[model samples]
Target: MREPADLLITDCSLMTPEFDILDNQYVAIRDTLIIAIGKAEEIKDKYEPKEVLEGRGKLLMPGLVDAHTHTCQQFLRGRTLGEYPMIWSRILVPFESSLSEEDTYLGAQVSCLEMLKSGTTSFAESGGVHMHKVAEATIESGLRGAITCSTMDTGPFIPESMLASSPGEAASRIEELYRAYNGAGEGRLRIWFALRQVMTSTPALITLMADKAREYNAGLHVHLAEHRDEVSYCLQNYQKRPAEVFDQFGALGPNMLAAHNVVLSDGEIALMKERGVKVVHCPRSNFGSHGFPKTPTLMQQGLSIGMGSDGAAGSSLSLFDEMRVFRSGLHAFWGLPIFDPVVIPAHELIRMATSGGAQALQIEDQIGTIEIGKKADLILIDINQPHISPTHRMIPTIVESVNGSDVRDSIINGEVVMKDRQVLTMDEEKILYESGRALPRVAVRAGI
Candidate 1:
């Protein structure tokens, strides 16, 4: 007369929030939450599971959370390689502006499939038009996301179609999207307000969007101090650094998720620290375009930092790759300088991908860890492979050696979206075919 579990995974190595690996562990999922987790032998017979996944040779851990990405930029993958700086205006804007609703949907489908198969259970859309399309793709793909609409009022080279008439219009549009999509898909989706960036947004729009997000209890996503151009623009326009501009507008808060942060002044970092602003580090994109960010310094200051792929346009939609790049870059930049090779150790880096990412998105209470009452958003990695073999130290191996291809299963919100490397919720073949067919039309429209 034991409890009936919706899904059960037994005989797996479970990863704790502390980054410790527990062998012979079993996790029981009932509906959308983890109901029980304990030693496999002691707990295997306690539940009558509707479905059971043999987790032997697999590691069950909290799925990676991508704190920032661009679903609409999925098709632009490999298009910006070796491009100059300010590709946002030179390349990305035209492409995004040219996309139709259907185009956006297709891009989202491709992006979702890439992320899910690569072990990302949750992500935050950096902001784009036709976000409903992205939301639809996310819901259909069974992934969790905080999505936002692209909001811009004034900036050089911005397309007329992408600009809002005024700050009020931008705030109204974002509020509408929040009302329509926030907490959608059984709370798997949350709508957020976007500032796009300091250069693209006016002070009025920034303040208004911040106020609206607070009113709706939603998050505000923005790119802060991401590059030299943005910092220069802010200094010229407002006589302040980019992060300082947000503080001046009273727009910095816990609900604000700022990406890149490649060029923050010490004062701005301190201000952001005081305001509890979350940070998303896009290592591949940032390092190539802007120099290395103050990741180690930010971590030392106790900022909540998360990893992001920034979308497939610049980097692969895999947090595993981001983790590797971030760690190596940090070791070279900070570690070599200070003669300390252990700068931002592997365990801490993995924490940034998991709990830190959930914290950045303000969803830690629901998803980030393997514990009872938390939503069952998890990934199973087949670690019995050649690359990850001889797993002497589990955490280091996960951070250093493991790649997205090792992800054997992905479960989000208690549903097994990908099992045995095959995506269950998404039509992979149809999406791949459609993406190939649509790219030519998109390139023509984008004038790429």
Candidate 2:
């Protein structure tokens, strides 16, 4: 008989939902599942594992999850930092037109490396074209990702590949991608349909994409109401707001994942909550945009809120950066004394980046928390740094002090994809080199 996964991580501080700190604990893993989590002495006594890993002076928490991203945009980092929405659209569309399959793969690889090192084990991606390259990179990186190929039908700004000739073609391509990669990578990779932007997609295409997503029981990912111009365009063209138009097309549901809902009315927020549609709050992207509305009001109204880095162009694909931006934005929006500024408590921020995001993606039961029977997806943070000293409150210290360099080990599906800050699946040096080579080409095509 097999040894039954004989792996044990002992003598660590475990952060369970029930307890703030469970010191000197052990987590047992078998195959791809977490078999046990309890006191170190008790677990060591119960099952004698073939291999034991020491976790002394480390903190073990659920792996971070990014609810929204554009993995293929990593090459565009620092290029679109100060541009407006229209300028961004102009730059992005033309740049995307020049991306080859190799460029997409390289970009995804670079982004995945940044994510893994930063303690994100899973993420949902919204990329322009080259969905296959994105999927391949995610699989090779040993990270769980929900990949969506951007789809559009009628937009003066979008590229040709994103827009199919007709709604039927759009639906067909989405179904083909879903059938090919939805359950691939041993369930580590999922496929979803992405409407590139609210104004970019037609009403008929939106409804058809939603129907296709429902048929496959997959999530519909889209960018909605990120800027005032987008909302105004929708209002001018459709005589309704972006969210209302989505509602009219039957696109707001539990299976929908909307990004950057920064300009929503009270009714629109309520409608989103009522329909169980999840929103991803990308503070860094909003700050970069310079005109995003307040999101704390929507958060307070009991809407499912998750965190995302947006993309390299706006947020740099770093969850730590996103958390810092979220903290600052919350403090600015909700003043001190009465509100405390720390609207998202440290523990809650971690949860938002992990379980909250999984819930938004409807994958909570599989890989969110560090519970038994869940996937063994977790990160070990080296809390021995000077900034993390006086560790009176571990969670808060981690959220406020720690950076991506503090992540010592990253495990997903009982597999160690990164150890001691070294990525195991892909070559980081090569990715950097390829990205450097591809950026000039992208910039030229984008007319920057």
Candidate 3:
């Protein structure tokens, strides 16, 4: 007889990268990896599964990946929703700086639950002083993340808690963080180096970080060319564009993910393509910021681009919402009589949320897709609702019709983190209750 699978999912309508639906399919997981997948009838007889999940009336897809987000900011979700200057200077800075380790842990607990409920299995956290606390929460929540330690040494009015004081101090701290948590949580959690941004980071700081990332074959995440003021500062001080400074410092590479690349020049885009630098687009977050990255143009130029929510402040932890917003967002903004309004198809949006994000994190071969020999990171979305009726056509319905709340179950690393919208690893009710209580304390500590 064939080997027994640790878990089995059958009768699922599998969503493919080509946007086709494979109805009545089955997937088998052994340990933490996908061992087999095929037609439901065929696979059912092939393996003896310890546990079986009837995936009837559901859609199975590779779990979503948020290529750029701040778990640290989940604590201040609705507390700050004003304009840019105040959003950054008065709110974001103080709020982040004021987080105690416990407060940060609470943020991670709730945010990870939010993502699982919304169908995100993996995410790239953009580093914060309290990021290790986020790491602890991920370990407890069974979320896969490329998390980081926030290393900011300089910037105007930066809070003292996040300041590293010098390049050496920042480098040492990064090394310590990496050694402690780089491959923690049974290889589900990764520790990447975060530079914060160009305005605050010195060349030495990022250069050292680049070397360290390369040495370990890890990815680096940072904001690049997001704001107009950032670009102006780079030109004034670095004698080049913001992207150019990154290029010169050896920070622009395949493993580097630059978030909110809103102001890329043609040459910079070409340079990014040449360097294999990846990008993360935060559509909701960009509404009041500079502008959305020229995604259509970037896609044409052959750059690997992914989608991000930027956490609760920038957007919700829902890549489902990001997908709809991003697809419509692209056309409604600049395609008026200039080009086809439907330039980006729903299929492309799905790719950006999955395989493209995998390439961005330099883990394309591992967890992004639901293929045999890949880690078992997947979610099941319930489509037995009125909103997603007319099941004859599933792709567009999944893309445009379905929302994050439709995600009914989630499995990560061969573990069912959630079942029927109930999170299995963490205490969902307690996390929600504590998040509300911590918000006021965080704000009070920040004196905002």
lDDT of each: 0.90, 0.81, 0.85
- The digit string of per-residue lDDT tens for model 1 on 1-448 reads 8889999998999999888889999999998999999986667888999999889999999999999999999989889989987888888877899999999999999999999888999999988878888989988999999999899999769999899999988888777777787788888999888899988998889899888889888899998888898888987899989988898897999999999999988888889999999999999998888989888889889999998888888879999999999999989988998899888899888988999999989989988899999999999999998888887898888888999989999989998899999999989999999999999999898898
Candidate of highest TM-score? 1
What does candidate 3 score in Cα RMSD to the true structure? Answer: 1.4
Candidate 2 per-residue lDDT, tens place, 1-448, comes to 2334557888888888643878788899988888988885557777767666668878888888899988777888877866756755787666776778888888888889999989999998875778888888898999998888778888787677656899888777767777878778788989887787778788898898888889888899988888888878988998888888998998889999988888888888888889998888888878767444556676688777788988787556667767776776777666553667566567667777888789878899988788999999899888767998767887777767888788888888888888778898889888888788888886776566
**Candidate 2 ranges with C-alpha deviation above 4 Å:** 1-3, 48-51, 290-293, 336-339
lDDT of 2: 0.81
lDDT, residue 257, model 2: 92
Residue 373 of candidate 3: its Cα lDDT? 93
Rank candidates, TM-score, best first: 1, 3, 2
lDDT of model 1 at position 47 = 93
lDDT of 3 by residue, 323-414 (tens): 88877778777665577866787788889999888887788898777789998999998988899976678876777988999999999999
Clashes of 3: 0
Candidate 3 — what's its lDDT? 0.85
- Candidate whose lDDT is highest: 1
lDDT of 2 at 174: 68
Model 2, residue 259: distance off in Å is 0.5
